[model samples]
Target: MDSNKRRHVGHRRDNTVLPLAAGVAVVAASCLTLFVKALLKRNSKPTQKQGKGREGGSAPKSPGAGAYVRGMREREYVRLIPDVEMLSLQSLLRRIQKARGWQFRDDAARDQAWARVLATAQSAAGGAWPLDFTPNDVTPEQLQALCDAVEAEFLGGLLAEQVRRAGRPRIRVVLGVDPRDPYSWLSGLHEDNTIFVNSNRWREEVSQDNPLVFEGALCRSKLEALAHTLGHELTHAVVLNFFPAMDASSPAYTPDDKHGPVFMWLNRRLFGHVGHASKRLFNT
Candidate 1:
C-alpha cells in the first residue's frame, strides 16, 4: 500500500512539473518574441511606398474570400449612429480630451489620456465597458460584448433597415486573435460574415508605438485600434449585404478590389476614417 501511495505522489509531481515547465517555456518564448520585435523596429526605417502593404497601413488578404464584387451596392450610403461628420483617431481623442480639459504631455500623461478612453467607451457602451489592463488578458467573450455594445450604440440604427431589406440578421462581428501574424494590423474579413480582430497584433502595435503606456492604460490604444478595424470590416459586411461568401463569388472579382474609391467614400460617410485602411488610406 505504501509503495502504491508513493507511486501516485510521483505521478502527481510529474504532471505538476510538466505544466510548470510548459508555462516557463511559454513565458520565455514570449520574451524572445518581444525582444526580436523591438530590435526589428529599432533598425527598420519607414518606407513611403504605396500599396505595398506595410504595418499599420494594410490588412492581410481575406481568407477564402474571392475578389471584390465590382459596382455591387458600392454607391449605397447608409445612415450612421454617431452624428459627427468626419471621424479620425486623433479627432476622437481630441474631442474627449477637450471635453475634460486634458492635454497630452510626455509619457507621464498616459493615465490622463487613458481616462478619456474609458469615459468615452463607458458612455458609448452605456456603462457596460469591460475593463482590463491589457488586450492579451481580454477574453473573446469580453470582446464580443464590446462589439455588441458598439454595434448597438453606434451602428444599431442601420441593422433594422439591413434586415428589412435583406430578410436576414445583420452581419455579426466575431473577435479572434491571430498571434502567428504579428505584423498585421487587422486580418481582413472572411467569407463567413465574421470579422477577425488580431488582438496579438494589437498588443504588438501598442507595445511598439506606445511604449510609455502600460497596464490598463494600454487598453486605450487598443480600443482606438479596434474602432478602426471594426469600422472597416463592418463596412465590408454592410456592402456585401451581410453575406460575404456568396457575394464574393461573382465572376467580376479582383483581390483587394473591394477597397476601391467607392468603398472608401462609403466608409468615410458611414463611420469616418478611424484607422489606416491601406497604404492608399495612409495614417488618419
Candidate 2:
C-alpha cells in the first residue's frame, strides 16, 4: 500500500484520551489476569464426565452414533475460555471503534459493527476471501507446518508483488514457539521478521472440524487460528517494511495507529476479522 492509503487524516488534540484505547487497555489487563487462570485450568486433569454439552447437560443421543460422538468431541474443544471469549469480543469492538470511530452504548446500538468489519475485509479481498486463502485443519504438531504453509502461500502470491514494488528482496519470516506468555498466543517483531506462536495457553485438545466462535466471528479451528495469527503478524511486517511512515516504534503512535488501515484491511481479508485469536479453551 502507498502512503496515501496508509496515512490517516485529522489529528487528535494533544493529551486527549481515547475511550476505545482505554477500553482495550482494560480488556488487555483483564485478559492477562484471566489468561493465567485459563492456563492452569487447561493443564489440570479433566474428570470422566467432562464430555457434557455447553450447558453441562448430557451429550445428545443420535442414530448416527459415530457422528454424535464426533460432534460431542468438537463441541468439547472448539471454544475459548469464557473470560478469553469475552475479552476477545471487547478487543474486536475496540478495533472496530478505532477503525471507524464508532461508539456503542449497548449491543442494540452496535448492530452494524460486525457488518462493517466484514465489509472492510471483503473490500480488501476484492469482494470475497482471497483465492489463495485456504485455511486447513491443524493438529498440535502441525502448527509450525501450518505457519510455513500460510507464509509460502501468501508470499508466493499477491503479497510478493507488494515486496517487489517496494524494491525489497525476497521476504522470509522466522517462526518461534512462545511457551512463557500466558496472555498472547502470538506476537511479532517487525525489525527481525520473527513471529512467535504460543500453544501452552491453549487447550490440551483441539477439534479439526469445528470452529471457535468469538463474538459473531469464526476462527474455523486451531489451524485457522494459527493461520490467521501468521497473517496478522505478517501484516505487521508488510506495513512496517513497506510503509515506514506508519512504523509503531515512534513514540507519537497510538495503540490504534500500530495496526493502521492497511493492517486492518489485510488481516480482515485473511481472517474475516480485524483482530486475531490469542487463546483457546476446552469445553468443560
What TM-score number comes out for model 1? 0.43
Model 1 alpha-carbon drift over 4 Å, by segment: 1-133, 160-170, 177-183, 205-220, 242-257, 274-276, 279-284
| Residues 1-284 of candidate 2: C-alpha lDDT, one tens digit per residue | 46554443223432245777788899999999999999999869665466453332344333223221111222332221132332333454455445434344444333343334333333433224321232232233343444445544443334455566877644453334453453454445445444555434343333445555531345544444444556567656655665465454422121343543234333443334433233233323
* Model 1 lDDT tens row, 1-284: 99999999999999999999999999999999999999999668555463233222232233333233323232221111111221332343354345434343333343333344345555634334433235555555555555554444334445435556876654554445644444454656665456676555554433234432221122234555564456566666655764344246422222344664335444544444422255311122
Q: How close is candidate 2 to the true structure, as a TM-score?
A: 0.37
C-alpha lDDT (0 to 100) for residue 67 of candidate 1: 33
The models' CA-based lDDT, in order, is 0.46, 0.43
User: Cα deviation in Å at residue 135, candidate 2?
Assistant: 18
List TM-scores for all candidates, in order.
Answer: 0.43, 0.37
Q: Residue 149, candidate 1: how far off, in angstroms?
A: 3.0
Q: Would you give me the overall lDDT of model 1?
A: 0.46
Residue pairs in clash, model 2: none
